[model samples]
Target chain A: MTKYSPPLAERIARGIGHLMFLLGGTWGVFIALPVSVAIAADPIQLAIWGVFMGSGVVAAFAAWRGLYLIEYATIPAMAAGTLIYVAAITNVVATGENPGSGLALFLMIALFSYLTARWFSLNQLLDGPLKLLFKRRQGLDE
Target chain B: MSIGTVITLIAAVLGSSTLAAIITAFVNSKRNKSQSETEARAQYTVEFNAIVAQQNIQIERLEKRVNQLEKAEDYIDVLIAGITNGTIPPIPPRI
Candidate 1:
C-alpha cells in the first residue's frame, strides 16, 4: 500500500538503533581526542593514546557511511582495538598503583565485546534470509 | 595518581567505546541491507505468482473455446449430410 509504507514501530526501532550507533561513534572520538591531548607528556603513552583515539575517528566515519558489512568482516579488527585499549589502561593502572582501575578497563572491554558479538549475531540473522533470496535471484538471472 | 596514568586510563576507555561504536555501525548496515533485499524478493514473488495464475486462467479459457468449436463443426457436418441425402428438406418452404 502506498508503495510499501514502513511501519511506525519499525521506523522508530531503526531510528533508535542508528542513534545508538551514532552516540557510540561520537563518544569514541569525543573522549579519545581530549585524552590524547592530556597524555602528550609521555611519548610512548602519547602515541598509545593517539592511536587509541584515532580508532574512534575511524569508527565514527565507518558509521557515518553505514559500512557495516566491513564491521561484520573484521572480528579480529575489533579484538585488536579492544586489546589496545585494554593494554593502555593496564599500563596506566599498573603505573599508578591502582589495580582497581585495571578492572574498569577489563569490564568495559568485556561489555563492549559482548555487545559487539550480539550485534553481529543479529546481523547474521537478518542476512541469512536475504542471502537465500539473493541466490534465488541469481539463479533466475542465469 | 600521576597525570600520565590518568590520561592513559581515560584514553583506553575511550578507545574501547569507539571500537564498540564502529562495530555496531557495521552490523547495523549489513542487517539493514539484508532486510531491504528480503522485502524486495517477497514482493517479486507475489507479482510473479499473480502473472502465472492469470496466464493459466487465459489458457483454460482458450481450451474451452477450442472444444466448443470442435462440437460446432460436428453439428455442421451432420446438417450438410442430412441435406445431401435429403433426409430432411431445407425447412419445407417455411409457411
Candidate 2:
C-alpha cells in the first residue's frame, strides 16, 4: 500500500490549530499577565484571567498529547472569558469611562472562542456526551 | 437600549455568523478529506486485486508447463527401461 498524505485543507486546518496554540499561549504569558499587573487588577479579576489563560495552556497541552476530551475544556473557559469581558465593559460604562478598549477586547475574545470551538469540532476532538449532543442536534434539524 | 448594549448585540451577531461560517468550512473540508481517502482506498484495492489475479494466471500457466515436462520425463525413462530389458521390440539396427 502507498503512504497516505493528508489533503491540503486538512493540513492547513491542523496548521491553524498549532498557530492558535502558539498565539494563545504567548498572549496569555506576555500580554494578559503584564496588562493585568499594570492595571493592578483585583484578586477576582486576576483569578478569572488566570482561568482563561490556564484553559488555553491546558488545551494546548491536551492537543499536543492527543487528549481530545480534555481539549473540550477550552469551550467553558472561553465562555467564562466572554462573560468577564461583558462584565468589564459594563463596569466601565457604569463608571462613566470609555468602554472602547473593553469592547474591543470582548470582540477579540469572542472571535478567538469561535475559531477555537470550530477547530475542535471539525477535528473530531469531541466525543462521548458532546458527540451525542451534536448528533442529536443534527437529528433534530433533519 | 444603551449604546453599549447596542454594540454588544452587534458583536454577538457578528461573532455567531463568523462562527457559522468557520464551522461550515471546517465540516466541508473534513468531509472532502474523508471522501478522498475512501476513494483512494477503493482504488488501491482494485489495483491490488488485479495484480493478484494476473500473478495467479501466470502461476497456473507455469504449473501446467511443469506438469507436462514431468510426464515427458517419466515416459522417456520408461522407454529407456523397456529397451534395456528388451521387453518391447527395439528398432532394428540400420543396415
Candidate 3:
C-alpha cells in the first residue's frame, strides 16, 4: 500500500498554522494584556486588547487539539491587530513621536495575517477544488 | 516619506506578496501531482515489461518442450514400423 503524504503546500500551511497559534497566544496573553494594564488603558482600549487575548486562548486550544479552528481563530485577530497597529502608528506620528515601534508591531501583525490567510486558502483548496478536480480526473481515467 | 505613503507601500507589498504566494502554491501543487502520476506510470510500465519478459521466457521453454515431445513421438512411430516388418529385433522376454 502506498503511504499517504500531504502535499507540500499543505505541509507548509500546517507549519504556519502552528506558528500562528503560538504567536497569537503570546500576543494576547503576554504582550497585549500586560501592555494594556501597564498603560491603564480605558475600557474600550482594554476590550480591544481583550479580543487579542480571547483569540489567543482559542488558538492555543485549537492547536492543542490539532483542529482547523486555529486558522479561523487567528486570522481575524491578526487582521484586527494590524488595523489597530496602523491606527496607533498614525496617532504616534500625529503627536510628533517616533512611530517606529508601532510600525514594527504593524509589520508583525500584517505578516501573521498574510500567513494565516494563506493557510486558510490552501486548506480550502485542498479540501474543495483540488479534491474535486482529482476525483473528476480519476473518474475520467477510469 | 509621509506616514500615509509608508503605510500604502507596506499594504501594497503585503497584498501582492500574499497573492503571489497563494498562486505559486496552487501551481506547484498541481505540478507535484502530475509529476507523481508520471512517476507511477513509469514504474507500472517497467513492472509490466518485466512480467512480459518473464512470460516470453516461459513460452519459449514450453515451445522447446513441445518440439522435443513431437520428435520423440516420430521416433516411436518409426521403431513401431520396423518392429512390425521384422527389420529391427524386439526386446527378448526376461527370465
Candidate 4:
C-alpha cells in the first residue's frame, strides 16, 4: 500500500493569506473612514473615499472566492481589480478632488490585495498535502 | 469635525494605510520566495522519480536482449563442438 502525504505549508499559507485579505477589508471600511474624517476632506472627496471603500469590498469578496476555489484566483482578481481601481482614482484625480488622498488609498488597497493573493498562491504551490490532494483528485497513485 | 479637519483626517488615513500596505508587501514577498523554492524542490523530486522509472525500464529491456543473444551463442557453440568431434559430421550419403 502507498503512503499518503499532506501539504502543510501550503495550507498554512492559504489560511494566512485569506486572513490578511479579510483584515484588509476590515481596515478599509472601519479604520479608513474615521481616519479620513479626522483629517477633513470635502463632500466630493468623501464621495471619493466611499468609492475607494467600495472597491476594497469587491476586492475582499474576490479574494475570498479565490481562497475557496483555485487558491490562485486571488492574485489575478486582485491585480485586475487594482488596475481598475487605479484607473478610477486617476479619473477622480483629473476631476480635481483631493487626488493625493485617493491615490494613497488606491495604492494601499492594491498592495494589500497583491500581497495577500501571492501569499496564498505560493503557500498552496508548496504544500505537500495539497499536492497529494491534487494527485488523488486526478486518480493518480500517491 | 470641521471641513478642514476632515480633509486632514483623510490625508492622514490614506498615508497610514499606504505605510501599512508597503510593510505587508515586503513581508509577504519574503514569505513567497521561500514557498516558491519549496515548490520547486517538490517538483524536481517527482521529475527525478520519473526519470529513474524510465531508466529502469530501459535497463530491463537491454538485459532481456543480452540474455537472448547469450542463448543463441551457446547453441552455436554446441553445434560447432559436435562438428569438430566428428559426432555430428556433415552426412552426404543419408540423402
Best by DockQ: 4
lDDT of each: 0.51, 0.51, 0.51, 0.49
Docking class of 2: incorrect
Candidate order (TM-score): 2, 3, 1, 4
DockQ of each: 0.04, 0.01, 0.02, 0.06
**Native interface contacts kept by each candidate, as a fraction:** 0.07, 0.00, 0.00, 0.07
Give me the displacement of residue A120 in model 1, in angstroms: 4.0
lDDT of 4 by residue, A1-142 (tens): 0011225454455455445544554465467644434244455554444444444343344333332223332343334323333444544455566567675666757675665566454444443434546767889653
Candidate 4 to native Cα RMSD, angstroms? 15.6
Docking level for model 3: incorrect
| Backbone clashes (count) for model 3 | 0
Off by over 4 Å in 3: A1-41, A102-106, A119-123, A126-142, B1-95
Q: What is the lDDT of residue A61 in candidate 2?
A: 53
Candidate 1: tens digits of C-alpha lDDT, residues B63-90: 9999989977777777788889989545
- Residue B71 in candidate 3 has what lDDT? 78
Model 2 gets an lDDT of 0.51
Off by over 4 Å in 2: A1-41, A93-95, A102-106, A112-142, B1-95
What i-RMS does each candidate reach, in Å? 9.7, 11.0, 10.6, 12.1
Relative to the true structure, candidate 2 reaches a TM of 0.36
**Lowest-sum lDDT 10-residue window in model 3 chain B:** B31-40
In order of DockQ, best first, we have 4, 1, 3, 2
